[model samples]
Target: MESKSYLPKDHVDILPCMAAFAVVVETGSFVEASVRIGVTASAVSKQITKLENILSLRLIERTTRSLKVNAEGEQIYEYCKLVLESSANIFRVKDKLVDNPQGLVRMGVPKSLYATCSKLIPGFLSAYRDVNVQLVCGERFDFVTDSIDVGIIVTEKPPEGMVARRLFDVDFVLCSSASYISKVGLIAHPSELAAHSCIPFVGDLDKQYWKFRSSHENCDVPIPGRYLSDCPEAALTATISGVGVSCLPVCLAIDALRSNQLIKILPDWIYKGALQGTAWMVYQPGHHVSKRIKVLVQYVMADLSRLSTTWKLM
Candidate 1:
């Protein structure tokens, strides 16, 4: 780790010295080199002195008012020029990558959102052939720990220190198959659910409840059922098959509802429970986002905007 270990005690480092030496040679004057490097002329002169002392060679011949690189300095300057060109090329390649939408983007998506996000990714990849996507499916994710480039999160407000764009509100509707409703006989109030076969989502145990909100009041009805599942799509499937009544996101059931395959159980009441929030696309805040991530966010946001309109009609 110590550069001094490779040289004598009094000898200074080589890279900085070489850089200063090369600059002085190319500019032809210590003052001009110092200006280009944003340093004082004396500092540049000191670097050249340290470099000469380390090499045990006089690389420059200078007088009170004139300066010139000798034959030895000229030879070393050629290698220095190559080093400088290599450094410049490295930065140019980095700039090209940052400005181009071409790389793998890792995205974290909640499990239930598969029905929504799965539809958008293929089109994005088709439109930007050079870009690739890796979808990480889960209920929750830590962007830093998980190395997620962008993700969908459901919350009342966006998490702190993240750049977020609201996609839509996370809402659900109480629905079941028309055959199940006819078999059980239609009931008017939310309390009637207690007597019927009500479906509980995956984690519920002992007791399950459903919240209902109307213009005048809110109700919490106890849900009693024999079927349980974690996936929203599965819940919609079970409800469509007349297994029981379940609360499902409108995005997942809008098409079925439109086709009369499923009917809303409480049309006048909106389900207002744990699943309510504004779904947002969040990523780490930075001065410059990578082009791959930027394009993915833009594409997903636009697609979600169009999809949200259909949810309203349902």
Candidate 2:
């Protein structure tokens, strides 16, 4: 099969114009995007119009007082983000040599692991005195759209594209507060959970079926939860208050387990087949990796080695 070449023509001069169009669409108004780029609103409007003409399609729908990006424009905006960031990184590469491990390193981490991972950042900053780090800590994240330098995501599979550095296992633990277990008694089997109170986080998966696996067997317990949340903290708080049992990452529940604040259930069975099964460090493997980013990743990798082991619930 013959592969068709991309960029068969010359659009080099209009790349900046595309960027301008992107900003207007992203900011939802030419005025706001112009303020951001330090340009006149009319100039931004003109650039977008030029882009629309070149593409032979309407990118934005503008009323007297409002602006909206059409479907085509929204898709282009995403590409513009990648192109602009890649262009910016090229310049950042030149600055890397002199600065060494000094500059801003944008990182994304699950908010649930912040408490566990936050310790590494302070040590990294102290060692690289000139480097400053910014973190986007949250459950929901988008590396490309959000401009995340690196993202630590807990999932059974890494994202399909970009680049990924497999970090370690993120073993899920079926846990509850010690008080809750004392009242409800210990869960002996995965199937027994159906009769007990449970807390589940809401996501794309089948929420009613909680899965567990053993050396030779696997089971999906039809456990129901009255409390459903997107935040791990909410589930943790609920579990702590003796509300229900919730599956949590071992890293998030480490302190609780160590302090006897939380109790692990069905120790013989693995909290398997759920979405949160492993940890991966994901990023776009562009041509250049800044010195600061390299150093930070090194530090993280060294520290994260300890996290790979099958979690000890003690």
Candidate 3:
């Protein structure tokens, strides 16, 4: 004695069929609808048949040569048209974003690479006026918890499940201010460092050795720290201020070396210390990358490429 509901219980399951029905109605041929929908004509016929079975109504009258929409089919076609339009609008929004990107793109950067990363951001924002960048500078980064869109890290091997672009190799070299070198005299060999006031980046006591490698041999000097700091930038600043000879990344020390503020010691030897590897710009891999992040990555890489030429980072 109760009135029955007309709509199917699993209404959400029929969206694809509704879309096919709408396309078929518009095209007036199953083969033509299949072309538009990127499916076979038989597949389109099956979807229509399934839709009719689900609703328990014959929505279309068909013969070998002719096809016609019944009264119920005509009513359903109106609602189906709306559904198709709504689906199209989803992709249209993405297209608009791609053409003219506008949004916030958060970047995670380590302190070691902060100077280089920060310098490029202003130019990126100037070019993309609608997009803004937020630099989350730290020693380490968490992609999910930090909501980081992009990150720059120094590592021998980049983490798995990421898209990594190697910017440049980080080369560490022992350098000191010209004044400090003049006072301490020239270091001809690795053993000479032990005699001079050394600034080792000792966050803890365990990292006390500076390993030097030439093409022919390797030398490990145990550093007795007259001045020490964990941060590379601090060590760099101290060395430039004539505090003591400290190991510094070449990219960090290049400008100083060119300006003759810092003098490179033991030029034949490579610093085989803890901080050594290539710096990579990394992001999560996905089929659909946002326009803002995509443009930013391209812009930053281009800038770094130009810098690498001048800095000889390659």
> How far off is residue 4 in model 2, in Å?
32
Indicate the worst ten consecutive residues by lDDT in candidate 1. Answer: 198-207
Worst 10 residues of 3 by lDDT: 199-208
Candidate 3's C-alpha lDDT?
0.84
**Runs of candidate 3 exceeding 4 Å displacement:** 1-9, 24-79, 102-110, 136-150, 155-166, 182-188, 192-197, 201-206, 215-217, 224-230, 283-291, 312-314
Selected candidate, larger lDDT, 1 vs 2:
1
Q: Rank the candidates by TM-score, best first.
A: 1, 3, 2
Identify the leading candidate in terms of lDDT: 3
State residue 239's C-alpha deviation in candidate 2, in Å.
2.4
lDDT of 1 by residue, 83-202 (tens): 567778999988878766798999988755777899999999999888999998775788989999999987887889999988888677788899998899886888888888877666
Give lDDT per model, in order.
Answer: 0.83, 0.78, 0.84
lDDT of each residue in 256-303, candidate 3, tens digit only: 888888988888888885557788999999998898999999999888
Q: Quick one: best TM-score, which candidate?
A: 1
In model 1, the runs with Cα more than 4 Å from the true position are: 1-14, 25-42, 54-58, 63-79, 203-207
**Residue 263, model 3: Cα distance from true site in angstroms:** 2.3
Q: Is candidate 1 or candidate 3 better by lDDT?
A: 3
Better of 2 and 3 by lDDT: 3
